[model samples]
Target: MNKVSQILVGGALGLSILTAASAADPKPQDTVDYRKSVYTIIGWNFAPIGAMMKGEVPFDAAAVVRHAQYVEMMSKAAPEGFTKGSGPDAVKDTEAKPEIWTNWDKFEAKMNDFQQEAAKLTEVAKGGNEGAIKAQFGKTAETCKACHKAFRKD
Candidate 1:
């Protein structure tokens, strides 16, 4: 084939590959697992901060900031894991409620709030202000509670 024809054919082939890859959805369980895994990581990272705040553990400012940064990063990622077919009906074992899929807009708004609060916590942690960090961290934790209250199934 001529150069122009070869280039056109190559472009078309690449587009087809990209389209097929995008169209292949993840398994329902995979989606559920992903969201759960993200939450698990967030929890693991958050525990240290909670301990520091409660005085159960020695206050490690650097550790608190690191954990806060991790939570902030993961909060941004958590929403994408709750894809279609990740709901309780599609997965036999999950804590997600049907309302997550049914009332997606509200659920998404809660996720956004979580992300915002997490960001605030990261900012406060960076400032080395224990009081402000504690206050903002409490607010961020409350954001998690709010979402759990609305969406989590026990």
Candidate 2:
């Protein structure tokens, strides 16, 4: 199969496993914790690429590729954290808005957008072109912002 198909299959499998785990876990807190952990890893890996793109740090093609890989992986891993019972009503501390569940289709679309853009970013980063990587980063960040605006709280 092609790389995109492979990633889609892997992501689907990962999501199912996570959904099962969420179902098995006894508390909403467990799901919340899992969600938090996944996002933390994503943000952690995503920051340096933004720094490089912004000129806060010298551009490093290798580092961009490395960070992009993690971002892409975490994007795939993200679905596991958003199972049904993990919303604001169940876990008061989460920044995830209730609409994530209420508007599940929209939220899922945003998540898919993120996953696709992140995958594209990883592939573009591999090319080692700063300009192209920067553009891809913007696209990925736009997906994040769209999701956050519609589904997350400040």
Candidate 3:
């Protein structure tokens, strides 16, 4: 290769390596920020259901179904390991307790149960039966409470 062409190729390779390294080594704060982003989306998706349950807003089955899909997606996401002393920030405003970090297995089981029950509730909502909606919604709420009671701080 000509001298100029060789230099150009070497520069390109160096740039690629730098890019890959940066991508692979995310900072701890960046990881915490990503977790918070996921939590925000999940909270937004759940807000409508909470409002409807409280009778503060009218229920929309289509909205519920869409948000349920989000919930299912989130539930399937692997839990991120928190950086030391980062637990409080990671779970800010979530009913999720620090115990979730301490009792990893139980926390994961509860999360799985939430996913399964939420999926069922989505299916039930699609059936267009008001009575069934009420029943399944109650069940889902209870599931949330069960987890909170065991794992959440007041």
Candidate 4:
């Protein structure tokens, strides 16, 4: 083939491979694991912040802001983790309820609530005011509980 034709063919082949890879469905276990990891990241950051807010531990301003930021970042990616086949019925041992799929609009609204509240909490934490962070922290935590109450199971 001529040089231009060869370039076009190579680019088309690369594009096809990329498209196929992106379109391939994830395995059920992989979906479960990914969703778990995303939640774990949120929980890991949230624990210390909750402790600080509740005075169960001495309030560390830096840690509060740090962890809040982590939650905010992870929250942005949280929804995508709940892919089409990642619901409870798709896999064993998942705490996510089938209601998440059935009541998807409600479930999604709750998820968005967390995203917004987490963002607010992130801003509050950055301000480093214990009072504001404490108040917003409660709001943020409530969002989690709301979603859990509706979607998550024991």
lDDT of each: 0.85, 0.87, 0.65, 0.83
By TM-score, is 1 or 4 better? 1
* Pairs in clash, predicted candidate 2: none
Candidate 3 regions exceeding 4 Å error are 1-22, 81-98, 152-154
Residues 1-154 of candidate 4 have per-residue lDDT tens digits of 4323533553545673333322366666666776788889999999998888788999888898899999999889877778778776778879989888888999999999999999999899989999999899999989999999888896
lDDT: worst 10-residue window of model 4:
14-23
- Give the candidate number with the greatest lDDT: 2
- Per-residue alpha-carbon lDDT of candidate 2 for residues 1-154, written as tens digits (9 for 90 to 100): 5323433553545663333333455368777877788889989999999999999999999999999999999999888889898888887899999899999999999999999999999999999999999999999999999999999999
Ranking by lDDT: 2, 1, 4, 3
Q: Which candidate has the highest TM-score of all?
A: 1
Off by over 4 Å in 1: 1-24
Instruction: Judge candidate 4 at residue 88 and give its lDDT.
Output: 67
lDDT (Cα, 0-100) at 80 in candidate 3: 59
Error of 3 at 103 (Å): 2.2
Better of 1 and 3 by lDDT: 1
Candidate 3 per-residue lDDT over residues 44-92, each given as its tens digit: 8777876776668887878778876776576555265343444565435
Residue 125 error for model 2, in Å? 0.4
